[model samples]
Target: MQPENVRQASYRGVEDPQRLYLAMLQDGEHDAREWLSTQLRRTASMADDLPDDPAQLESWAANHAAQVATDHTRYLTRRHQGAPRHYFANRAHALWFLQQVAPTKVVDGAWLHGVLRHWRDFRFHGLIRTFLEELGDGDPRCNHVLIYQRLLSRLGCDQGLPLDPSRYLQGVVQLALGRHAEHFLPEVIGYNLGYEQPPLHLLITTHELAELGIDAHYFQLHVTIDNAACGHARRALQSLRLLMPGQCAKAFYDRVRQGYRLNDLGIDTPSMIVSFDLEDELLAALQRKRPYGQFMHSDRCRLQGRTINQWLADAEAMPGFLRALEAQQWVRRGEAPSHSRFWTLIDGPQAAMFGVFTAYEKQLLHDWIVGDTAAEDCRRVRPGQWERDLALEQDAPVAQGEVCVDRMIERMWGNRHATPNGLRATRDFIHATGLTRAGPN
Candidate 1:
């Protein structure tokens, strides 16, 4: 089926990755294939750094691991020398990075879905296990997508920008890889190899996010699970070596190289982290709210000699209006938000304007008012303080009018994985695939 809103809703551009994601899920053979040829061509110029021989993959991974360890040690030394965060300038910046990357994280491990049905093949077990882990084996807490969803919810970053095409590249490539794997198994293997290797940035990001009181379990989870010693990194290499065809090996290796380089197609993490502009983000947030807010406020209150509605009338007035709020003490910049009269008006339920802003808008306003203290001046939680394992409360009460899932069984359905009948079918599939013979992925 299509994603939540593909046919009815229009996204940023005609080639939005979200559409391609569901399109690939729904029908990858024809439509998705037609689009991929143009996109995959761009990966042509990328360097083929992987070894030409499959047998050397483990050795290559070991060397890469050693180099990463050395680089991270150097990074730690610099940090201990009274340096600021290498990735984030502040908590707001960190939050922005998370939001920008949410499109990919929400569809975690989608590239392996195509490999799941190949569980009968022992070589496919590794990839299958990775996919299952991404699903947390049906446990809500461990599921990568669920964890990322919870992280965004906790930070009020659920309403993120989905307009950017770059935001959807990795995610689209992944979901499209169903037999987007069977069609290009070598490329999928190559992509997995590149993705599983833990980077120095992941380690530093995990450390810094915790220092900002952000629950970094999502990044932390990657750090631990992608470990070079015995984790997905090793698994990726092992799987590749075993699965690579013996004859026509050179053509397969060529495809694998192309797949490895595909990981480099989108904006890298470091570049995105350094790109945050607090004022620009704030201005954009205000601009989006301008239309709805333009006529909503009354003339009862005045700021800078104009009524609140008058202050918000012009798009150009947004910046000056912010200045007016600060000048009139409506917003106390660089201080605890509670100390400002404006903060109370939109924060608590008792406040007059609590529902005016969405969670994302409120976060932007909150961070802007709090200013520089959004990161440093805030109290830091010790690492692991907020890293508790989450358990799904199946018996939890649902209040009236709340959204709930009610499954409709269809005997002819395909992979409705969460329902009782679906789960039973999955178990039967697993049994049919001979999991015991395949062993641990």
Candidate 2:
């Protein structure tokens, strides 16, 4: 039966069963693991194309299936603490974890041509595409769309201000030809922008790090960042602190104490501010061990120097960063912010990851503000009567025109929503414009 070969099944629009099978595992369906294990043995027996020895075949099938399952659990447990709901900071980390769990079909896009010649992964490419799409719709504070637009352009997509959504996530990047290009994710409604570019920060709780199978003894060696002091860089270090293993807490405390006394942050001295260069050092540290957080400090890193005295002042200066930090604790409580929280998530062990998370939030804000450009066009073209018609529509009851009005509301002012303050501004605009609904007349 050999599963009828994927090519043969293509006529029926059927894909390789392995993908469906793997998806089930990823979805955490109750019977997925058990069913996959049983199916492996059956599939092995039915496969006559390979070796004829049933015992060897079954052993191989079982091992492969088990390994796939094991990797999935291992990585998931480490990063997510087995919760599956904990936020991840960046799409790269998510993509990387997915690759580790399943490698067979995760190949490079063909368009990458000879660019990413060393890589191969179709599913990975698709997943990234899907994520970008969902991210645009799901979060108002998203900045990734434009940045990805640039990344896609590098892959040879056409030039444009607003990105072509399809090409941005789906195209292949020619990493071979490029070196150190920075992209901006503009300030959007719900998200506060610290840098036009990313690598905002990484945040990790001590509990999450422990689950990663890292020992606390090497906390200093383990949690290194590219530059310290840039807002994102500073937050990454603080978040990494939560990850200190219980055994290493004393050592961690001692080091921090020593660094404090010496007017240095010890291993964290680098974190006091952002640095301009350190990519090689960063890559080496990550490869050696999972560094707590690494950040692409803002372009300003070149200007900010490392010093404990300097850091205390720097932290005091970034009001947005401070508010963002306070609001994040509230986010854990599921409450709206009383005051604006901007770049707080950019600091902590998970700050880099937090940056990615915040980017999506920012996108949500941007979407809310832009709203319906057509209305603006209509206002210009049709003029006064259309305003009267819009006013008339507002008098209708929710049951009659709620959906349409909601759609109109979103369309007309989506872009105005890049931040909580923006929402207030929109409300003020509505009031000023006399746009409030009167319900059924």
Error of 1 at 56 (Å): 3.1
lDDT of 2 by residue, 1-441 (tens): 111122011111222344443342233222323322232233222212222332243343344335434644565667456343232222222222222212211211111111111112332222122222212221222212222222233222222122112111111111110110111001010011111012211223222323333221111111231123333223322332333346855544333222112111011111211211222222332232222222334434321333322322342333332233334442221222212233234334554445343332232222222222211111112111212322111222222243443332332221222233333332333333333423587
- The global C-alpha lDDT for each of the candidates, from Candidate 1 onward, is 0.68, 0.25
TM-score for all models, in order of appearance: 0.83, 0.18
lDDT of 1 by residue, 1-441 (tens): 011112112123337676666555455443555445445566676555577677787788888888778988998899899877788776677878888887778767766767764656888888777666556554555656767777888778877763466677777777655445678788788888888888777888888888777888888889888887878888887787788788988888888877776677666777667778887887888888888887888788899789878767887888898899889999998888899999899888999998887766676777787776544644565433432555443432222221211111111022234334433333344334444324488
Best by TM-score: 1
RMSD of each: 7.6, 26.8
- Give one clash count per candidate, in the order shown: 0, 74
Scored by lDDT, model 2 comes in at 0.25
